[model samples]
Target: MLKTYSVSLAVGILAGLIYAVLDVNSPAPPIIALVGLLGMQIGEHLIPLVKRLINRQPVNLHWFRHDYHHKIGDNPPPSGDKTS
Candidate 1:
Protein backbone atom coordinates (compact mmCIF):
# COMPACT_ATOMS: atom_id res chain seq x y z
CA MET A 1 0.00 0.00 0.00
CA LEU A 2 2.78 2.38 0.86
CA LYS A 3 4.56 1.49 -2.36
CA THR A 4 1.40 2.04 -4.39
CA TYR A 5 0.80 5.45 -2.84
CA SER A 6 4.45 6.39 -3.21
CA VAL A 7 4.38 5.54 -6.92
CA SER A 8 1.16 7.52 -7.41
CA LEU A 9 2.66 10.52 -5.64
CA ALA A 10 5.80 10.31 -7.77
CA VAL A 11 3.72 10.13 -10.97
CA GLY A 12 1.59 13.07 -9.91
CA ILE A 13 4.67 15.13 -9.15
CA LEU A 14 6.21 14.21 -12.50
CA ALA A 15 2.98 15.17 -14.28
CA GLY A 16 2.86 18.51 -12.48
CA LEU A 17 6.47 19.15 -13.46
CA ILE A 18 5.68 18.37 -17.09
CA TYR A 19 2.69 20.70 -17.07
CA ALA A 20 4.83 23.45 -15.54
CA VAL A 21 7.52 23.00 -18.18
CA LEU A 22 4.97 22.99 -21.00
CA ASP A 23 3.22 26.11 -19.63
CA VAL A 24 -0.14 24.37 -20.05
CA ASN A 25 -2.99 24.69 -17.59
CA SER A 26 -3.42 21.70 -15.37
CA PRO A 27 -6.76 20.03 -16.09
CA ALA A 28 -9.16 19.55 -13.18
CA PRO A 29 -10.92 16.60 -14.82
CA PRO A 30 -8.01 14.21 -14.42
CA ILE A 31 -7.67 15.03 -10.72
CA ILE A 32 -11.34 14.26 -10.12
CA ALA A 33 -11.13 11.22 -12.38
CA LEU A 34 -8.49 9.56 -10.19
CA VAL A 35 -10.51 10.31 -7.06
CA GLY A 36 -13.61 8.83 -8.66
CA LEU A 37 -11.69 5.77 -9.75
CA LEU A 38 -10.36 5.29 -6.21
CA GLY A 39 -13.87 5.67 -4.82
CA MET A 40 -15.20 3.04 -7.23
CA GLN A 41 -12.44 0.64 -6.27
CA ILE A 42 -13.13 1.15 -2.57
CA GLY A 43 -16.84 0.67 -3.10
CA GLU A 44 -16.31 -2.47 -5.15
CA HIS A 45 -14.40 -4.07 -2.28
CA LEU A 46 -16.44 -2.69 0.60
CA ILE A 47 -19.97 -3.16 -0.76
CA PRO A 48 -19.86 -6.90 -0.31
CA LEU A 49 -18.62 -6.55 3.25
CA VAL A 50 -21.32 -4.00 3.97
CA LYS A 51 -24.01 -6.30 2.57
CA ARG A 52 -22.75 -9.18 4.68
CA LEU A 53 -22.82 -6.95 7.74
CA ILE A 54 -26.43 -5.84 7.09
CA ASN A 55 -27.55 -9.47 6.75
CA ARG A 56 -25.70 -10.51 9.95
CA GLN A 57 -23.42 -12.79 7.99
CA PRO A 58 -19.79 -13.41 8.73
CA VAL A 59 -17.43 -11.54 6.43
CA ASN A 60 -14.82 -13.91 5.11
CA LEU A 61 -11.59 -11.94 5.34
CA HIS A 62 -9.37 -14.87 4.47
CA TRP A 63 -9.43 -14.15 0.76
CA PHE A 64 -8.80 -10.47 1.33
CA ARG A 65 -5.76 -11.14 3.53
CA HIS A 66 -4.57 -13.83 1.18
CA ASP A 67 -4.72 -11.46 -1.76
CA TYR A 68 -2.89 -8.72 0.09
CA HIS A 69 -0.13 -11.10 1.07
CA HIS A 70 0.02 -12.42 -2.44
CA LYS A 71 0.41 -8.90 -3.84
CA ILE A 72 3.30 -8.22 -1.46
CA GLY A 73 4.83 -11.63 -2.12
CA ASP A 74 4.77 -12.39 1.59
CA ASN A 75 2.90 -15.68 1.29
CA PRO A 76 4.65 -18.83 0.26
CA PRO A 77 3.49 -20.85 -2.72
CA PRO A 78 1.65 -24.09 -2.04
CA SER A 79 3.87 -27.01 -1.18
CA GLY A 80 4.48 -29.65 -3.81
CA ASP A 81 2.77 -27.59 -6.45
CA LYS A 82 4.78 -28.21 -9.58
CA THR A 83 4.54 -25.41 -12.12
CA SER A 84 6.46 -26.00 -15.27
Candidate 2:
Protein backbone atom coordinates (compact mmCIF):
# COMPACT_ATOMS: atom_id res chain seq x y z
CA MET A 1 0.00 0.00 0.00
CA LEU A 2 2.81 2.38 0.78
CA LYS A 3 4.38 1.53 -2.54
CA THR A 4 1.14 2.15 -4.36
CA TYR A 5 0.62 5.53 -2.75
CA SER A 6 4.25 6.51 -3.20
CA VAL A 7 4.20 5.69 -6.90
CA SER A 8 0.95 7.58 -7.39
CA LEU A 9 2.31 10.66 -5.64
CA ALA A 10 5.48 10.49 -7.71
CA VAL A 11 3.50 10.26 -10.93
CA GLY A 12 1.25 13.14 -9.91
CA ILE A 13 4.29 15.29 -9.14
CA LEU A 14 5.83 14.39 -12.47
CA ALA A 15 2.60 15.29 -14.24
CA GLY A 16 2.50 18.64 -12.47
CA LEU A 17 6.08 19.36 -13.47
CA ILE A 18 5.35 18.46 -17.07
CA TYR A 19 2.28 20.67 -17.09
CA ALA A 20 4.32 23.58 -15.73
CA VAL A 21 7.06 23.03 -18.29
CA LEU A 22 4.53 22.84 -21.15
CA ASP A 23 2.39 25.67 -19.81
CA VAL A 24 -0.67 23.45 -20.35
CA ASN A 25 -3.46 23.61 -17.83
CA SER A 26 -4.91 20.41 -16.39
CA PRO A 27 -8.01 19.46 -18.34
CA ALA A 28 -10.23 19.27 -15.28
CA PRO A 29 -10.38 20.85 -11.84
CA PRO A 30 -9.03 18.81 -8.95
CA ILE A 31 -12.43 17.92 -7.55
CA ILE A 32 -13.65 16.76 -10.93
CA ALA A 33 -10.50 14.73 -11.43
CA LEU A 34 -10.92 13.11 -8.00
CA VAL A 35 -14.50 12.19 -8.75
CA GLY A 36 -13.42 10.67 -12.05
CA LEU A 37 -10.80 8.64 -10.21
CA LEU A 38 -13.41 7.43 -7.74
CA GLY A 39 -15.65 6.43 -10.60
CA MET A 40 -12.79 4.53 -12.21
CA GLN A 41 -12.12 2.62 -8.99
CA ILE A 42 -15.77 1.67 -8.69
CA GLY A 43 -15.93 0.71 -12.35
CA GLU A 44 -12.98 -1.63 -11.96
CA HIS A 45 -15.04 -3.95 -9.75
CA LEU A 46 -18.31 -3.76 -11.64
CA ILE A 47 -17.51 -6.23 -14.39
CA PRO A 48 -16.27 -8.93 -12.04
CA LEU A 49 -19.23 -8.39 -9.75
CA VAL A 50 -21.69 -8.61 -12.60
CA LYS A 51 -20.11 -11.81 -13.82
CA ARG A 52 -20.29 -13.35 -10.36
CA LEU A 53 -23.95 -12.45 -10.08
CA ILE A 54 -24.71 -13.75 -13.54
CA ASN A 55 -23.14 -17.06 -12.56
CA ARG A 56 -25.34 -17.14 -9.43
CA GLN A 57 -22.41 -17.08 -7.07
CA PRO A 58 -22.80 -16.02 -3.48
CA VAL A 59 -22.21 -12.43 -2.42
CA ASN A 60 -21.86 -11.89 1.27
CA LEU A 61 -19.68 -10.30 3.91
CA HIS A 62 -17.47 -13.36 4.04
CA TRP A 63 -17.06 -13.29 0.28
CA PHE A 64 -16.36 -9.60 0.37
CA ARG A 65 -13.78 -9.82 3.13
CA HIS A 66 -12.12 -12.90 1.74
CA ASP A 67 -12.35 -12.22 -1.97
CA TYR A 68 -13.54 -8.93 -3.42
CA HIS A 69 -12.09 -6.39 -1.03
CA HIS A 70 -8.49 -7.51 -1.38
CA LYS A 71 -8.65 -7.28 -5.17
CA ILE A 72 -9.47 -3.57 -4.89
CA GLY A 73 -7.26 -2.54 -2.00
CA ASP A 74 -4.45 -3.53 0.31
CA ASN A 75 -3.83 -6.89 1.93
CA PRO A 76 -6.36 -8.14 4.45
CA PRO A 77 -5.68 -8.30 8.14
CA PRO A 78 -3.72 -11.28 9.34
CA SER A 79 -5.70 -14.47 10.00
CA GLY A 80 -5.26 -14.22 13.74
CA ASP A 81 -6.81 -10.76 13.88
CA LYS A 82 -10.40 -11.28 14.97
CA THR A 83 -11.29 -7.60 14.69
CA SER A 84 -11.65 -7.92 10.97
Q: lDDT for every model? A: 0.65, 0.76
Models 1 onward score TM values of: 0.37, 0.56
Top candidate, metric lDDT: 2
Q: Which stretches of candidate 1 lie over 4 Å from their true place?
A: 1-28, 63-84
Rate residue 77 of model 1 by lDDT.
42
Deviation from native of the Cα of residue 49 in model 2, angstroms: 1.2
Model 1, 1-84: lDDT tens digits are 999999889978877786678675667468765875687578766776687679997655554453333444556545664332
Clashes of each: 0, 0
- For residues 1-78, could you state the per-residue lDDT of candidate 2 as single tens digits? 999999999978886786678776786578866875787677878887888899999888767777767666688845
Cα-based lDDT at residue 73, candidate 1? 54
- Angstrom error of the Cα, residue 6, model 1: value is 35
lDDT of 1 at 66: 39
Q: What is candidate 1's CA lDDT for residue 40?
A: 56
